[model samples]
Target: MVTEQHSFITSAKRVIDIEAKVISALASRLGQDFVDACTMLKNCKGKVVVSGMGKSGHVGNKIAATFASTGTPAFFMHPGEANHGDLGMLSKGDVMLAISNSGETAELVNLLPVVKRLNVPVIAMTNSKHSALGQHADVVLDISVEKEACSLGLAPTSSTTATLVMGDALAVALLDERGFTSDDFALSHPGGSLGRKLLLKVSDIMLTGDDLPLVKHDALVADALLEISHKGLGMTGIVDELGVLVGIFTDGDLRRILDARVDLHTALVQDVMTVGGKTTQPEQLAVEALNVMEAHKISALMVTDEARKPVGAFNMHMLLRAGVL
Candidate 1:
């Protein structure tokens, strides 16, 4: 059992090493062909149609998704399905990215003629440059691996990893060319945590109006404590006579006052408040607010307007609940 466990570990390490080497060697191969491919994809007036067979087909689906999320319009069309009516999905302005490790997958090769007839340019990701798909393609991206991780050298292992990495390289190159921003990415992934972080403004989930835990500067510490408890935000905003934000008092401040043994009944709220505590704008991204809170080691922040008047506020719990944390 010990020997078998050792053999399993050794095989796993070898597989990882082979895949790693395949990815490492990809950088040096980024030359004129890669640049031309990116330029072609960038200049394409229509969407990208990614097609592949078997394992390559699975990888192509993800590549298409990455392209779509990162500002490029793309979708996966199975090569086998394309000949049966899915071919209607392609148009003259579109570009096709066909993936085949050997570059001669029959189902994919059969669809090349229709792809070319439609005037759609083909970008081939394959090892055999002379293969049917490669020969018909407008651009050939070499995704050849030195060897498979399989001892029999039959299964698609390192080759598939190389193809996937090459697909990522193309997608990212196109992404950079288009100057795709995080906000743009968030728009495509509205259901994910990243979308919440990017698209959700501080104002969207902040406590505003009557929900704000607020007290006048002249208010006693006891008054502030009552406001904090009633609001349940663990803090209260302090405003001056003009109703402008002046300071903030938090549960942490109460702890310090407790240590100092200050008379809560007689202590002025302004005297115990943290003057000029961290503040955020209503329009700022919630993620930005999170960064500020984490940086200052504070739990809550006052949302202020241009004139420094308190408009709204939020705490770490609010951010977490809103999926911005």
Candidate 2:
């Protein structure tokens, strides 16, 4: 007479252990068929169309997105919807991957006749090679397991885990075959911080034109400091009359100049400035700016053109605002 709560907890741990072993065993079953599946996808001229029913459909959708973001170009289609007109999403050049733990999902099976008429390649992902979907597919990837994690063996825990692992194995194999790079992945996920770090360019984040804190070298130190304060970037670029950078004046230089008792009003901006100031090019990646800031231990950096003319300025705060830090 075990309590229901105690029984549930025991069953839950057993569920986890069963799925863990199922995933471990799947690694040993990979062979030439896996290589053949990778080949079909790499040579595909059209998109990879993934289909599934119920729980397997949910995992298939995630797998498709992973494939697309990694340069494999894929999308998930619900087989139940295929009968309702979503089958138009497939093309002769496209490869369709159908997922079903039992390989007997009626919705998936109903679409197979039309899929065959279109002459598209079908890769069936199923636990039973003799199941309907597996029997009809051009290539069958066996995902069979001895039992489900559920004590009643009715829930899909272990089977779904194996299906997800198989999908990831396929997606990663294709990604490697295509030499998909991190920067390529970043382009598809621009809203995330990792994407910003990899894809964001300096020009996209840099202040430019009138936003630049620029002052002539002959101006009084007080006037240049005013520009720095107005721009709110803690530093100002000291330029010659031709608008070329001659030097820079930061809060640090201002402190040293004050220590020497230099008259703020009388001193020329050039005399108190830090010459040949550290700068970044507008074409550089924003992440590179982070490295430069770290290396120099500086709070703000001025963006310059190839000719060293000031174009923009920013500090660590901008990185936070951009979600790139």
lDDT of each: 0.93, 0.89
Q: Candidate 2: which pairs clash? A: none
Candidate 2 lDDT tens digits, 47-115: 999999999999999989888988888999999889999999999899999999889999999999999
lDDT of 1 by residue, 1-325 (tens): 9999999999999999988998998877878889989999999899999999999999999999999998889999998988899999999999999999888899999998888888899999999889998899999999998999888999988988998899899999889988999989999989999899899999999999999999999999999999999999999999999989999999999999999999999999999999988899999999998999998899999999999999999899999899988
Predicted structure 1, TM vs. truth: 0.97
In model 2, how large is the Cα lDDT of residue 90?
96
**Candidate 1 clashing pairs?**
none
List TM-scores for all candidates, in order. Answer: 0.97, 0.87
